[model samples]
Target: MTTSPPASATPALPEPTPTQSEQYSLTHGKLTVGDYLPKASHDGKPGAGKCEWSSHVSVALTSDEIGALAWVLIDSVMKARFGPAVQLYDVWREHTLDGTTIPEPDRQTIGSFVKPVFGLPGADKKKSKDHLHGHIGEWLWHLLTKDNPTVRAQPAPKGDVTDSGGDGYTIYETANSELRFRLWESKKNTGKGSLSTSLNQAYGQLGEHGQTYVAKIVGAYAQASGEGAAELNSFITEIPRAWTQGDVIVGAGVTLATHRPLPNKPFKKMAGKLPLLDKPGQLRGLATSIECYEELADTVRRYAWTAL
Candidate 1:
């Protein structure tokens, strides 16, 4: 593991102007895309309208990359549902009778939990929207943290429950040496108005209810058993020393322009029309436009059933 730098260390800032955009291949080649026009510096101590802000644009994902990413995402869903140590037999046994009887409603849901990526999931009993949000939340988590080992899945609550402020949460030690906690919320929409509504709600959670949510996730992981548990406990236990007051950050993943093709309007133009939760310094944003959303669902379902 790369040792985190001292909290006082000056963290490397994003390029004010990325010449050709930054390309990355993640999830073992499951995702390959570029981040363009990144704005790292914030004006006036990190609030809106204080700095020269530019929203970054993501290069459209290829079919293969999207397929691969779906696999990784579905794998995460399985892990979140069944724990990271889950196996092929475990999935097979739980969803099947004997060894060949597939459950009804749709075999694809079960297959979605373990299959390989071909396309995204289709509707099943009116739960497709919720399912899509869950997968996208996990996918966003992996994208932001690069699948940090310490990141744990927040199991889906049993029964018809709600009020979970965010879709997912995790804590990591920043290279700047501060232990930073991030709360993730993903919103999927096809149009700008609906997407903005969702994005605003997510931002609202991060702004108004962020601290309490952070405490809840910290408390849960602190008591849980895992390789990350000890470190997580230590970080939460010593919150005073781990971070200066008001140093935490919030992030949101918004799916925009989904109704249209890939490479939608530049991030700046879209972002200009949207509300800012706070200063760019305290918030991070991942704005994406998923072109083949239905295919993404199918791909996730495919990976869930196909991969061990």
Candidate 2:
């Protein structure tokens, strides 16, 4: 099943022209951002405090655009686990350096490296679904955070196997020049289940294990020797306390592929789920419902293999 904007809505934008780059870059101007939940409903609400409603954005993309995005992002996805200097990155840079097409042999080499990371094309059904859906959700959140101007987010750690910890992290600079850290957990609902239930699970996981997740990523912050590095490191070092002190923002988001209409209040139950961060602008929720999600995942996988 597929869902698209109504005829009265704005016309679909033209596809973007691909740019030549040494490193993978996000294809901007293609994502459609709109309100998923109303602001009036959240006012003075328990789980929904006075957070930046604008910050809670929803994204929609055409199938072709999604496939192209996967190609553009494959390098960064590879680098997330293998580092920036991976052989595949080198091969891509070399090919695009002269505006020439990558040779067939080179494409094969790229596919070889990519297939193992994502799993063979026709691998086990359960494992393949898990890898594809989980990575796609994380990737969507990464793109959203990167495009957001108010926060500087880290790329998700793309491990070959699932690991315990938060799904995403970011730093927000308040108007007062204070640094605030955010830990995010992302979930995807591929089954015929409730989106709120998935979100509740994400919040529960974060409430129980968010500290350990923050602790593990403290070293990654050390690489930021630029301004605010010291303060950021200190904030991350004190996890649960930082969350309590209003210096840390905890968020959870769920992505679903559905043809059904979304609930008017997707995140109404958030405050009751995890009441630790009840301050205004402290608890955040994102709900991304896409049409043909499983098909998109398959398309993304195909595009990734041919991205050389």
Candidate 3:
């Protein structure tokens, strides 16, 4: 009879390959994208009626995987930046392109370099709450678009600070490849009141300032270059007319911090809120609920510094 190998001599199990859902464009080399948020479920039959919306459960990330997802989200926005951050990002990108894992020391160095820009591990309570709410809302919207093959979204805001314009912008390509633009507003419910309070606020804000918001996004694209920039700019010029013709889509998403059961049709009641967007293919909504929301914010902050 043969004896078993000693612990040190036993072969180690190989790491499991990540599934398609767990992978992202930035998750190359040894970087693994974590399953932080659950697979989103359509609130109802999307596209069967007027508005489209989806729902998500509480985030499921421990300290183990939070950092990986945090890094991926940050990297996505970093694509639209310049200077030192881009330099650091390029270093990481080189490793991805080379199909090699970043060394532990380099990982720590890069993490430390970018941590302050993101306002991670924020000390001020109010600032931290606002930061988490705004960033997470924008991020969720960005992720939602990723699930739909026909939609291409602009990058989320790069940092913890919220901008004065719309929370997101997306281009939805129809079956024949005609592009339709969507302006999105995202909010978080931190008060003791209902999620509708936050969503209603988003609705009103979009109704009042939506045009100005769209203008800002279009202006930002004016500085863009590269192959498709001109084609994209042409589409941008049509947004005003599109808005008048009811071809543009307006969307609002809210993140609720509670354990209570959510409404089966959360956005149906708001059908009349934005009349222009009430019709088929014109309005979109998303509702994400999380337990211990503040705790998750703190955890995201802490794990962002994990490599350091």
lDDT of each: 0.43, 0.55, 0.57
Per-residue lDDT for 24 in model 1? 23
lDDT of 1 by residue, 49-152 (tens): 22222222334555555555554454444555544545643644344312244546345444544422223334342443444544454454345445445444
Top-scoring candidate (TM-score): 2
Ranking by TM-score: 2, 3, 1
Top model number, lDDT: 3
Which residue pairs clash within candidate 2? 47-271
Query: Which residue segments of model 3 deviate by more than 4 Å?
Result: 1-34, 44-49, 59-85, 90-128, 158-160, 223-229, 248-261, 305-308
Q: lDDT tens digits, residues 192-243, model 2?
A: 7777677678767777777677766664555556776776666666655665
TM-score of 2: 0.69
lDDT of 3 at 162: 50
Model 3, 1-308: lDDT tens digits are 99988878967543222122125323533242224555457755445335677677654544334434554554454444334566667765555434355688776666554444355233432344565655655665565455578864465554544557877777768677777787777777755778777777777877788878877877776444786566666777888656655554444333333333467777765556767665556677767665545554454443333333
| Candidate 2 C-alpha error for residue 296, in Å | 1.5
